[model samples]
Target: MTRTAILVGITMNQVNFDYSMEELANLAEANLIEPVGVITQKIDRTNKATYVGKGKVDEIKGLADYEDVDLVIFNDELSPSQIRNLEELLEIEVMDRTRLILDIFADRAKTREAQLQVQVARLKYELPRVVGQGEGMDQQSGKGGLKNRGAGETKLEMDRRRIKQQISQLNKELDSLVAERQVQRRNVRKMKSQLCPLLAIPMLESLRL
Candidate 1:
């Protein structure tokens, strides 16, 4: 299925801004996303809270609403807070380049090793973002303050623990794969060593003249 997306980029003295945005479009295409439009901001630096200027964000939000894009993709990596902020303002799905590339890698990963690696990378990327899951919900639960806080904390802790466990497990599996490959390489070297004498016999016979 093809999802429509809008590309957003901030040009802060970057000579290759155009190239990077083009690559971002290509990446979106690779992920089965159709880039319907591009929005760029020429700023001295990116806004910490929203990634782009407030005015630009408003324009982007209007453009996204007008175009009816499924999501908006940023050319640069965004902090968890930044993503949340943008999604709140835009009222649409928001993604950054790192997540976008990871998605592509995950989709194209066919082998077990490749899949495990991708999973590990994704877990690492998501670990920090899990800590603030219920910020809004906590604020909204004015009456059941203590209960809501406790539940949110417990859930957040559980998520962190789960992601950590998965990352550890994936690392162990990868280590085992590495060890197996090393053993196979050693066995091949041993076989080559054993065959060296036979190979020399042929050379010796050829030099009999």
Candidate 2:
């Protein structure tokens, strides 16, 4: 199913703002998202909290509500707080350009290595954004006993740990793959070195004659 989206951007002395927004729209379409509208603000700087001016955010919210857009995509990478704030205010899914590009790469990844690299990048991007949620993190529960280390860990904590572990594992795997390629390349060079002497023998004989 094609999801409708609205593209938003902030132009802060950017010479290629129009081209970047156009590329963002193309990216959305590539990810099976239909861009229904475009919104841009000419500002000296982005809002620290919302990544856009408050008034611009309000206008985006209204336009999104009216257009019934399923998602709003920003032309720049947004901080986790910005994403959280925008989603809260707009009541819709929000994605930044970095995430959109990653999604496209994920979808287009045909090889295992490509997929793993994408996963690694995504996990790294999400590592810092992981935060505790609701009563799950606050409530103290002792399923084993009273000696289970404080509140027995929250879902957010677990998520962060899991992502870190995955990132480490993926990095190791990527390194191993790269090492294997290097070894293969060395072997190929060795073979080429041996073949070069053999080929040179005939050329040298012809030159002597």
Candidate 3:
């Protein structure tokens, strides 16, 4: 069985943003998730909280339920609180702009370095507003025991710290690889320049220089 997804794109002009949204839908299809429906909105500016307006959210939610979709993919990045709210109301997986694109990137990151970078970025984005971490802060503050002490360090915090460390290490490795590529490029350029001078000598002779 295949999972179905829907692309919900909201833009000021349907003509202006339609192609990008369509491309995204294609990417979803390539990943084996069927993008069976689309919801477009012409808005002045995207809502900061919801990206799409509240009414549109409800509309999309209903569409997802009616379509029996596994996920609703938004075209813009959403706040952590917004994701939480939408998940609570929709009772389905909610993926925002960045996460959706990163998922696409991860799928095609055939190189080890590229794969590592994608994972680091994904975890960094996902660590915040994770379930139980943000919600338990207030509850933990009220408890008066050693177990509760430093309990404000939520699971998200632990994951965030671990992600940061991994990112740092990956950055160092990527940097080394980048430097190696630069040297390779330099070598190729040098060989091409040397060959060009030799080729020019024969051409100049052919012209009786």
Candidate 4:
């Protein structure tokens, strides 16, 4: 039999995140991810580097070990460095808020355009951190170029180059798609101009009330 692990979520929002966290754990369970624990940090704002506080992160790591958990998930977008740091410290698979939503969106994207849009958004979110990580690799590599590099190329340089190329390609594709969308939007505006209201439908409903 497979060993089960825990699901962890930390969110700064205190209002409606509780129900979402429970739902997420259920989804994880359905995927055979054992819900060992969840740690939430209800703060006014999310931390920039860690998302959660360092103190909270350490606490979660401890809980994971105590629970014998194999994974950790965050309820907010985490920088790439945040992922690297958490994975290094916890020795577990770590995923952020964006990744979870991206997984759900990818599965639900039926149209070719929808699929491409999701791909572009995911890559754009990832590219910055991939580039940022290369800075750390550069320091470790010292003066050496590709020879002292990691994997095939210098770790820092390679990730930067690859991410740059991918981002450029994705941008070109998105630009073409956006151009098509502009034409469609114009057509819709012309046809719906007579029926289009000045304000949002929700605001109109409130007025009716």
Candidate 5:
């Protein structure tokens, strides 16, 4: 099913700002996510907390609610704190161009090698963000409102550990596959070298005649 999303970006007077936003919409389409609305901020710099100014963040929140989007897609990659802050204010699933690209790569990965590479890239990308997510949760867990804070921390720890383990395993598999390919390539080269002398014998005889 096609999901709808709001496209968000901040333009710092860059020449390629328009092109980048257009590409983001195209990426959303490629991921089966329809671009229902677009929200852009023209600023000299990004908001360190939300990647957009407070006013622009509110605007995006309104648009997300109005469009009832499944997620909001940012034109650039957002920092983990920025993502957390934006999601908190917007109250919607947030995505960035980097994650969207990774999702597309994952969807198109057909071979085991390609899949392993994608998985590793994704895990690496997620590892830091997971820490960012845990930061806020861990802080809130001490408060009276969040009683199950310990459970949440435990789960986050498990997630972090699991991601690390998966990344390590995938890397090992990739290394093994790469080594196997290297050996195969060496064998092919050796065979070609052995056949070259035989090939040259016929050429030498023809030259003599």
Candidate 6:
């Protein structure tokens, strides 16, 4: 099923705001999220807690309810506190541009190596966000149908040390895959080198004939 979302952006008098928001919508579409509404704020700075002004947050909440959106996508990378605060205020799932991009890569990743790398990147991103929000994380993480949006509640249950251990393990597996591929490539090159001489003899015989 296609998940619907509300796109939120802030323009600090930047010229590329429109382009950035449009790209965010495309990214959302790539992840099978239909953008039902857009809310923009032109602020000198973002609210420290919610990333948007208080009034804008309320507006987003109203729009989210009206559109029945499953999530809200922010144009910029939000701090962990900002994410938590916005979700609490809006009573909906909240995600940032960084999270959207990560999810896209995770879903499209085909090979084991690529999958491992994406997982590692995701864990690193989730680490700080999950620090003091363990209880909340359990309630929200991986609660939806969006694939690869969160690291799953089980991982969120893990302490920082455990998450780091997982990241280390994933890196090791990636390294092993790289080494295995290197060996296979070397063997292929060696076999090709040996076969070239025999191939040259056949060509020489044909030339003589």
Which number leads on TM-score? Answer: 6
Instruction: Go through the candidates in order and give each one's C-alpha lDDT.
Output: 0.89, 0.89, 0.79, 0.71, 0.88, 0.90
Candidate 5 on 1-209: residue-level lDDT in tens? 99999998888889999999999999999999999999887888777998888888889888899889999999999998899888889999999999999999999999889999999999999998885354445443355336655543544677788999999999999999999999999999999999999999999999999
Cα lDDT tens digits, model 1, 1-209, are 89999999988889998999999999999999999999988888778999888899999999999999999999999999999899999999999999999999999999888998999999999998775554444443244666565434445666788899999999999999889889999999999999999899999999995
**For every model in order, what is the number of clashing pairs?**
0, 0, 0, 2, 0, 0
> Which candidate model has the greater TM-score, 2 or 4?
2
Cα deviation of 21 in candidate 2 (Å)? 1.3
Instruction: Encode model 2's per-residue lDDT on 1-209: one tens digit a residue.
Output: 89999999889889998999999999999999999999998988778999998899999999999999899999999999999899999999999999999999999999878999999999999887776672244434555444565757667777888999999999999999989989999999999999999999999999999
Query: Candidates ranked by TM-score, best first?
Result: 6, 1, 2, 5, 3, 4
Error of 2 at 130 (Å): 2.0
Query: Model 6: clashing residue pairs?
Result: none
Please give, for residues 36-101, the per-residue lDDT of candidate 3 as tens digits.
899888879877666778898899888999999999888777888888777777889988778877
Give the poorly placed runs of model 4, Cα more than 4 Å off: 1-5, 10-13, 26-34, 42-49, 53-55, 131-155, 174-209
Q: Over all chains combined, what TM-score does candidate 4 have?
A: 0.60
* Of 3 and 5, the candidate ranking higher by lDDT: 5
Candidate with more favorable, higher TM-score: 1 or 4: 1
Off by over 4 Å in 2: 134-136, 139-151, 199-209
Model 6, which residues run further than 4 Å from truth?
Answer: 132-158
Off by over 4 Å in 1: 131-153, 199-209
TM-score of 3: 0.72
Better of 3 and 6 by TM-score: 6
Question: What TM-score, to 2 decimals, does candidate 1 have?
Answer: 0.85
TM-score of 5: 0.82
Better of 1 and 5 by TM-score: 1
TM-score of each: 0.85, 0.85, 0.72, 0.60, 0.82, 0.86
